[model samples]
Target chain A: MNSLKQMLPEVAPPSREALLEGRGRLVAEARDEAASAGRSRLLKRRINPWTALTAGLVAGTLGVGAALAVQIGGDHRPPERVRLVSAAEVLSRASAVAGADGAARHGRYFHYRWQEISLPDEKSRHVLGSGESWVPAGGNGRGLQRMQPCTEGNAPDCDVVLNYKDGATDREGFTGPRSPKYLRDLATDPDALLARIRRTAKGDGTADDRAWREITDLITESVGTEPKLRAALFAAAAKIPGVVADMNTKDAIGRPGIAISRPGRSPQQIIFDRGYRLIGDRTLAVGKGGPEPGTVLSAYVLVNEDVVDRLPAPRPGLVR
Target chain B: MTLPPALEVRDDANELDMISHVNEQVATDDEIVTWSLRDPEVFATLYDRHAPAIHRYIARRLGPDLADDLMAETFLLAFRQRARYDTARTDARPWLYGIATNLIGRHRRAEGRFWRAIARSGTDAATESLAERAADRVSAQMSLPALTAALARLSKSQRDVLLLTAEAGLSPVEIADALGVPKGTVHSRLGRARRKMREALGGIDPLDPREDAIDE
Candidate 1:
């Protein structure tokens, strides 16, 4: 028990002087608050006839937590807990899952759809809802989006993000960091493929880090994806020293999965299910300017991805 | 007195190395709080007495970046709320822990992030392990990656109970007061937490009698 307790990393306490300064700050703030309230007393006295109503309003407004409390709530279903296993062990299992789930996916156009959640402010997060894109398998496509309802406060043309129609002449070739043609022709051997990626990757981080990010991004898109390449990608990822395994994680919808992520203040992550199939991606950011830490800066959970001869009509409830 | 080997710093085996000692123990924290109501300056004695441990506990929960700020806040809040101190309870650590725990809860998301990050990075190493054998090593130590992951996976309430008890050395009663939950609830949470953690340890409970036998 002591051994397990010992595992936690200790933070050194604030200096003695810092604590005293904090006390001083709190006292000063309190004095300022009291002084401000002194002026407000005249305003309150004028409104004294309605003081009861005012007090009730204040209490009601502040009782959000009380309002949210559901009395008698009992746990009906406990979440499925993962058995304690070594991170190395979980990663190895996840690698196997990824390898088995990998299959070459091919189609004329790469259509990807996902739900994204973002924090608009510290108070609450907003789900931007499902977003879909169809890129030419060769990396060119024109959008012909159907209009969707705009959010209540949004302008009538708020659906502009969705509603669009373009001529077939309007197109773009995949000019991504790795060219579409180059990606397709890349070797499948984990070593050879990683070497190719390292050679092509140009960035501030080390070649290994750049290679890791490129692989993660490429796998995120299933366009022209192949299972063999996906499996090899996992193998190649395992070779990168930065990528590690975490089973104590959940996808956007609360399904538990293992994750591989980078270290630092804000990290990008890829989540894989117990079966090792890619499930989602999430970015974590420490809330700047406030107490919010581990803010879900953005996240996307994969609904499903498959190649189709043609893009299907928006399905029921997909937009919601 | 046997102290819990908490958040063991690999290089800093000596806790004394981190915090300067005043080498004087006088009034209990509850007494200090009581006296602080009349004279707030006396509260500094309580902070001096307990801030290091509280800071360490907070740091273990939320990491060092937030620890200093949160630790200072905990003491300041203690100073402000000294009037409400329950004199029946002679120890103030539990109450201070309660305050620190609330602060740590604000960073709950970061805790999960750290767990996942540690697991994925595969290097929550304890620097140099103290175990006689690699297999005998305490998984709770940072050297073991999945343990923190397991901790992160615990239901937030359960994690609170486990951490408050294990890290802060608060008795179950103190935890109940600290968390505003019933004693029974604290016990149940601790039970559930340990059970889940035991499973994470491959059915080996660190506190189990069997583990003690292994050490023997």
Candidate 2:
């Protein structure tokens, strides 16, 4: 460190003359570029003055006509506009609802759907869809929707079904009939889950599959309801180096939502509604060993308000 | 309140005018950017304002040659992107540093190699080589390699905060803005980096009370 400090003395400050010279040169270059671009624009206008004059005249005429119309307007009063309530106000309202147990249970969940609309040259629009579903708390939650079948050229049919299980535990457990059919079914039994994941992952003999298995194991090892554990999971995820969480604010349906993006590789978006309630999440895996060409990964939706009355009592467990 | 006629008619008028002229010339950085957009020559004023400190920072990190290139690149990139520049930020140093950081990222491998070479050489090339200066140089050199090696081991974010605060002379908030991170994150990373550096430097912690007293 002393040696490094010694080196520090030799680190002379930059020469004032050289810096000034560089600054002058940069200024000169920028001025030249701007001047050239300006000259080009002037030349173009000079070559076609008629078009410019016509456009200017039309614009001037429109301005005068609009001004006169406004002066002689039938209704000078501005239209009544609805003011947008701030996020803070919405959160305060949600907090108040949470404070009242009855109001909390009466909460309804509104789902906001979005799709990517592609354009030419790799540009795409993240367009919000008109389709929405309202799931009410303490209701029999079941719905049927058209889904893609396994057969090719199959028409949209009522193939997909959504069922809301009341009085269900939020804990990680297999949904549907309780049977150890696949690897996920044994997740509740930690030892069995670990053994099966390891065995099956080894047999799979693919790097991507192994990575998934390892991630699953890590998640299982770090799973729990404890806030400390959740924070630990976030920290651990950050340690993976390339993974970054993109947090942005957006309106999910009518409710304020946060869109947390995992971009590029296995891009995913997790939307959290106002009051930090989990709303819906979608992921698109587009690289090697993940999903067929243009195949989106399975999406999950959780409407907190709809499941408020049905959510089982909290189970105590250490996160990690 | 009226001045004496003689005094009022004296060189004070010229002096006051000069002061106001200087003030107008050395306006806020945001004002400079807006002026630069209209007249590119205005950017030279900003380069004059910030280049000394920025040059010194680059010099300390990568030595003179690389520092020159980095400094030039930083200003050039800033000039090219001037159209998209946010005029709201009065202080342009953070924006300049952000550009510098991106340039530094590209040369990360070279940086690691430079540090390793310094560690192996037992003394940085910038250190004094005079016989009379040998004792101090040796002492400094002995610990420097270890320090550089340790610095090389730190995470990019940790290194960024440490270097920005210590060498670039930026405040924590400035560092946060440069890195596009929360201020709390900057503070924590600085603390962690300092601790790690101390630990790596055989427990001669810069923030420790005994060391602080010694420096004082």
Candidate 3:
């Protein structure tokens, strides 16, 4: 019997080629119908407040233009010597600390880290959702540059980023390097950036105002204490209308810190130290109705002075 | 007995290296869509790549005719969904199998009827063909009635994992993606399905246990 088992090359079932052929024809014919149906559904779509919140969180990690000006030591002058940090440095440090390790690659837009992180949330408590990604840098138009956390099993905790490319809009919430021109200077003369962003949103007249209103709402919702800083930041954001800022404050490995959400249709959050150095970001979406509030999505902490690592491997696989 | 050269080539091509090459080429679901979209004629490339084996799987379950229909439907659906295809994934087989599984689910009644008929007949074309071809036929023909009854009793999720892995040749990760479930869930479901199938078949040793077990 064992010999027979050895002899028989275990035959798998028949392929579904014939079946799929028929379905393909049907789908081609039904494309118009399906598309119409899909369009109708899209038209009736309501604004999901939670989606906006998650988008905000994702934008934070990607380093969107929504910077909060905290009064540090009553220094009114914008710090000339602001230190710039890359996303990769942050991810590496976090990966080492979390002990959920993985490798990362750097791209133009953002640093991609792929690793497993513990989710204290109900939806994915200890579930493994690890994959690679293309995280943007701090600067403008740095293309996607990294891939990490390639694994065999399906990790639902991981976020699959799609259409990440260089010169493309930072739609997915990943950012590039810090602008060579200081943001403080840009804040003073924000017409170029704001107009560019507003034009992208096709903002005209009322639409443009509405876009500005949303930006103001986010600023007020995010940092309401300092009216002066709020006004400055809001002006900057409005200058680049339709460019939403995702922000959050979370505890990374027991340390209080803030994270910027990556921007895109599906946003991700990046963690940072108080010093504004990129630590790591939450790569996975958590919670029940999407990513839950107050959950540690990702963290990149400083292990040593010079070297930093991503906590987990970036989610693997691209969608489009 | 004269050995045919074509048969020899066929045997050589079925080796691990060849299968792995095929697997590597079609490693992710997205790749499959890309390949199909790049050249619609290559749509048949997938069929030529996986049809025989899938045919064998369907034949094992519901004989030949139903298998043909199911297999056809699977590819057709895959082709249609190719546009919104996620290119990150390289293997298209699992996604194709997922669609096929859904179609099979719709024809559950027909499949059940086929199984009952085969069990009563005490002859399954897949099993009988194997018995005829092999020198040793012991345990070659599983109790069709038992297998059919057991399969019918198996939970939908379990059955999905088992069939997808065994017949569709998808990895656990791929199966999870296809089913939109977690990897652990796919593992547990597959395990449960196998255990049930064993129990249902009276723990009869697998008729032709493949060396590469599904889990491995």
TM-score list, all predictions: 0.38, 0.42, 0.34
Across residues B1-216, which tens digit of lDDT does each residue of candidate 1 receive? Answer: 111111111111210111111121234566556544433444654664566677777766666566768888887777777777778887888889998888888889977776676567644322223222423544433245577678878988998998887777778999999988899999999999999998886765533534444344
Which residue pairs in model 2 clash with each other? A1-B143, A1-B144, A2-B140, A3-B140, A3-B141
lDDT winner among the candidates?
A: 1
Flag the better candidate by TM-score, 2 or 3: 2
lDDT of 3 by residue, B87-184 (tens): 66656666666676777778777767765665566445545354233323324434445555666677767777876776556789999888779999
Rank list by TM-score: 2, 1, 3
> Can you tell me which runs of candidate 3 are displaced by over 4 Å?
A1-320, B1-32, B35-44, B125-144, B204-216
TM-score of chain A of each: 0.53, 0.28, 0.27
Per-residue accuracy of model 3 over A1-320 as CA lDDT, tens digit each: 32223223343343234434543554454455446656765764554466556766776778762532121112233112221122222232222222211112232222333334565543343424333343333223223323233231333233433332332334443322222233333333345545543554333345555445333333322210112222343345424322222212443344434333323212234444433333444543423576443344433332222212332333355322
Candidates' C-alpha lDDT: 0.57, 0.47, 0.43
Q: What share of the reference contacts survives in each candidate?
A: 0.12, 0.18, 0.09
Tell me which of candidates 2 and 3 scores higher on DockQ: 2
Better of 1 and 3 by TM-score: 1
Give the range where candidate 2 chain B is weakest over 10 consecutive residues by summed lDDT. Answer: B15-24
Which 10 residues in a row give candidate 2 chain A its minimum summed lDDT?
A78-87
Error of 3 at A71 (Å): 44
